[model samples]
Target: MRSMTRRNRLMAAIKYLVCAIMILVIAVPLYISVMGGLKSVGQLRAEPVSLPNPVNWNQYTDMLTGKNGSFWPKLVNSVVIGLGTVGVILIIGTFAGYALARIKFKLNGLIYAYFQLGLLFPLAVAILPLYLQLRSFHLLDSAIGVILPQAAFGLAMMLMLLRGFIKAIPLELEEAAAIDGYSRFGFLFRIVVPLSTPILATVSVLTLVSSWNNFFTPLLVFNSEKKYTLPMGVMNFMGEHAADWNLILAYLTLAMIPAVIIYVLCQKYIVAGLTGGAIKG
Candidate 1:
């Protein structure tokens, strides 16, 4: 009994140590970025970890006030792209997921396996071909250019998550709705939708975050500075203010705020959604 108790204590200590390490790993950089942004360029370099001597707020204000900056435009672009990607994913993914999970068909598994293959090939592998296709479609420098590809790539994962959750939904509900004069589409939109909210929220949050952080895809698709997304705005800071570490850090902190806010607000839903998808379906 003493040996078992000792082993449990050791394991608990190890777990706590790992958790503390992970928190530091994430929190330290965030701390540096926030503090660094409030310091002057020289102060940032000289006293990297020290609090700001005079607390320079110009870097952030300059970004927000658009003092020769494109922060607002870049932020708006990210919002548009993120929302659009999520919308497309949810719309198409729901139908596709429902069909795959609920319908009986011979080619269903084969079609699903084809989508599963997408998981093996990351987007970078098809960049050149994707560029060519976008150019041919005259979608270059357009939000749709970024939105469509992101949605398409995201569809696979969305389908996977949604399929399990949708399958877990009781079929008897559909029969009851059918007797009440609910059409198939009506039943899906009305009944299934409410029940599947958790998984859908999960897919939305994931796709939105992915679309917001996608730098390369937007870079490849958009050539115009006006159409540039937030990630691109980060690169601009690195280039234009290369020597000004404080300015760059300010930009990083500001750019990260929205996504951070989103994650914080929806984190509970994310956990619930993922759990529901995994265990129920």
Candidate 2:
């Protein structure tokens, strides 16, 4: 019994050690970045790992309202694109997920398999064709160009996630609503949608993050400075004289703020949405 107790204690100690190490690994770089952002170029180079002695604030201010155009507009662009992408994904994903989960149709499984197959195609492989297609429609360098492709790419995964969650919901609810003279659309809107808020929030958060962070798509589609998204705007910080490492880190941190806020605000829904179906099944 004493030996068993000792073994358990040993395991507990190891677990704590492992957790501490993991935290340190994740936190150290973030700390460095934050500290670096707070330092001058010279100070940063001299003491890259050290905490800011006096805590400089110029980096953030300069980055926010620098001569190369204010970051506010770029920030707004990111928000708009992110929100637009989420809206499109939600509308399409909800309906498709519901169909896949409940409706009987020919080759449903095969159709869904095709969607799964889409996930295998890397974005790089399709860039040239996508650009050509968008160009034909005069959508190249346009916001809609970025939005449509993102929505299309995101649909498959969103459908799979929401479909799994929807499957866990009992079909009797739909039948009951139908008997009450609710049209199919009404039943879907009033019943399934209201109940699926958790998953919807999860997908919304995911879609927003993905769209906001997307760089390559925006780089390819948007040529005008005014329409550039946050990631692309950050790229402009790069230069010869002084790489503006301070400003770069500051902008990077700022770029991440929205995603972090969103995740924190909707975390409970995300967790519940992701896990609810798993446990129920």
Q: Write the per-residue lDDT of candidate 1 for residues 185-221, one digit (tens) a residue.
A: 9999999889988788888988888899999899999
* Clash number for each model: 0, 0
In the range 145-190, model 2's lDDT, one tens digit per residue, is: 9988899898877887788878878888888998999998898899
| C-alpha lDDT score of every prediction, in listed order | 0.89, 0.82
Report the number of the highest-TM-score candidate: 1
Off by over 4 Å in 2: 1-7, 65-69, 240-242, 269-281
Clashing pairs in 1: none
Highest lDDT among the candidates is held by which one?
Answer: 1
